[model samples]
Target: MTLSEQIPSDARIAVVTGASSGIGEATARQLATQGYHVVVGARRVDRLEKLASEIGGTALQLDVTDEDSVAAFTAVVPRVSVLINNAGGAKGLAPVIDADLDDWRWMWETNVLGTLRVTKALLPKLIESGDALVVTITSVAAFEAYDNGSGYTSAKHAQAVLHRTLRGELLGQPVRLTEIAPGAVETEFSLVRFDGDESKADAVYRGITPLVAKDIAEVVGFVASRPSHVNLDQIIIKPRDQAGPGRFSRK
Candidate 1:
């Protein structure tokens, strides 16, 4: 049977990348509850399999940085009504002078090209779905720059721009693009950023209550559930305690 034929007639397919944990995992669970057959992809097969089992969805091993992996993952997906480009993260935090070229390369490859690869591979499937939504989880850094965060901020900026540009390029097409830029949603973000330094990661959110992964996932669910005509171009979500990049209200 063809890809479209493999799916239930009433079921809508939603693809979530970076779905091993945090926002991607939350979003996968959320979409599954909404009656979409969620196809979750990530590098962690164990976690992905557990999540897929819990949600009754399919789990596929996907490394967005690998072209063959992306191609293989997308090939089996059949159809995609919603594609969540959430496979991105930050690396080392350092000043330009002391910057790690390896860190920069990783950030660019994962955040920018990773999204491009997955999105490009599934574009045809997205369009063929008749009504599709592409939600890219960006960061506050996408629009603002800060000290010692040039690598991550630059990568996010490029990812956001790529998502935004798709809006116009697909104007009359059957797809809708939404860019979700979140401020301080506490997850493995700081832990990953600080290289598993628990104390440093804890310090990042010590002062204020940060938004959790579920907060952003709910917004994604909202965006995905909108009528086909309603295209939410961009949404910036931050906790009330957060004002901007470095501006936070610490109690």
Candidate 2:
């Protein structure tokens, strides 16, 4: 049966990390529209509250980088049938030789361990639901790497592998694990990566109409709404102008 059919309308709970903006925000809104009780989590409480109010979902303050924050956020929201590990980003674009060690550590902490912390805490609740789904938002960098993408690429690869391993472990279980990887999304991702450098952020999507947050959200909604028997392993969404990593079409 489809996920919407398998899940009771009232009891369907989804915990989406990084839900304040971008794909996380869009996904939370879309899921709420599909009748899921979406619990939005992020470091920005004000933004989370606004989004929650607009989407009619619960908002929780979460900093995936902190263990206590993750614990508190998970404890407050019970019965989560879906966990979207979307709290991750890249910090610097310098080459590996010139990159700072702290930047690499930060990327690994958020992209890999952050995802682990949230998923580990919610695994029991998901198992209890008997029709749970874990949708992780990875990136196209996971499969392909280019200049100045060492740390981010490595973290994406690790996160993707973690999801793959979890899917194998939960082979017979009701939990459906999947990953969504997108390329050149026009979002605050680059802004965060450049530490609020609006110019650099704008440059990332200068010539191309990159994938928007809603584009990724639509794919996520479709995947989460699929039949329980049909598991969409991984979906890679990219703008038509962007053929692959670092290969954006420019006029």
Candidate 3:
């Protein structure tokens, strides 16, 4: 890390979940670049360590699906000014009738419940910090349901609800709540959704240009950097080629 990227002693700490890879990793790297002492959390200890070392931040082994792990992660952080909940992904492209219960469970656990656990754990610190930001990464599916996105869509919508409730419930507080919903950002998302089937995953964004993890990460930094008086409730960004859920311009 260069001197320019080093966080000052007085800078408020930023915590990002799922920091091992994808958007979480990108957000951590971007926040570190913005002079924040970023505390990264994920289940993959080795990757987290490497990311922390590379970005000059600290890493904690955290499994958002586990209450104990979330607690342990919060214990390691002295204070938190920004909390980015990005530990979510699609499980399977199954219809509602053919949905696998296990896949749905995993999606719910990771997307909705994971956000609940981490936010509940760190919220007190954010409240005490006076000025804080909470950014939750949802998906376009949260607003528009599709044929094969039953489980993923429902789970992401729950995250969106959680974000909305937080904003309404925390009115007048210094803490701000923002939800970022992106459309078809090419990352590990497709691969994971297809159960590591490279061909299936590759087909999701075959001909059209999709958004990247860094693109969303940059937006996160922008939203979080706004003036304290300005609260951006939500940002729904899609690639120019993506019109909506299941609508893509293929070349």
What RMSD does model 2 have?
Answer: 4.2
Over 1-251, each residue of candidate 3 has an lDDT whose tens digit, in order, gives: 63224556587799999989899999999999998889999999999999999998888899999999888789767888999999999888888889899999999999999999999999999999999999999999889999988899999999899889998899998899999999989899889998999999999899999999999999999988899989888899999999999899999
lDDT of each: 0.93, 0.90, 0.91
Residues 13-32, model 1: lDDT tens digits? 99999999999999999999
Q: Whose lDDT is greatest here?
A: 1
Structural similarity to truth (TM-score) of each candidate = 0.97, 0.95, 0.96
Candidate 2: where are CA atoms >4 Å away? 1-9
Candidate 3 displacement at residue 187 in angstroms: 0.5
**By lDDT, is 1 or 3 better?**
1
Select the stronger candidate by TM-score from 1 and 2. 1
Which pairs clash (backbone N, Cα, C closer than 3 Å) in model 2?
none
Q: Residue-pair clashes per candidate, as listed?
A: 0, 0, 0
Please provide, for model 2 over 55-140, each residue's C-alpha lDDT reduced to its tens digit, 9 standing for 90 to 100: 77888899898999999888867588889999999999989789889999999999999999999999998998989899999999
List ranges where model 3 is wrong by over 4 Å: 1-9
Q: What is the lDDT of residue 25 in candidate 2?
A: 95
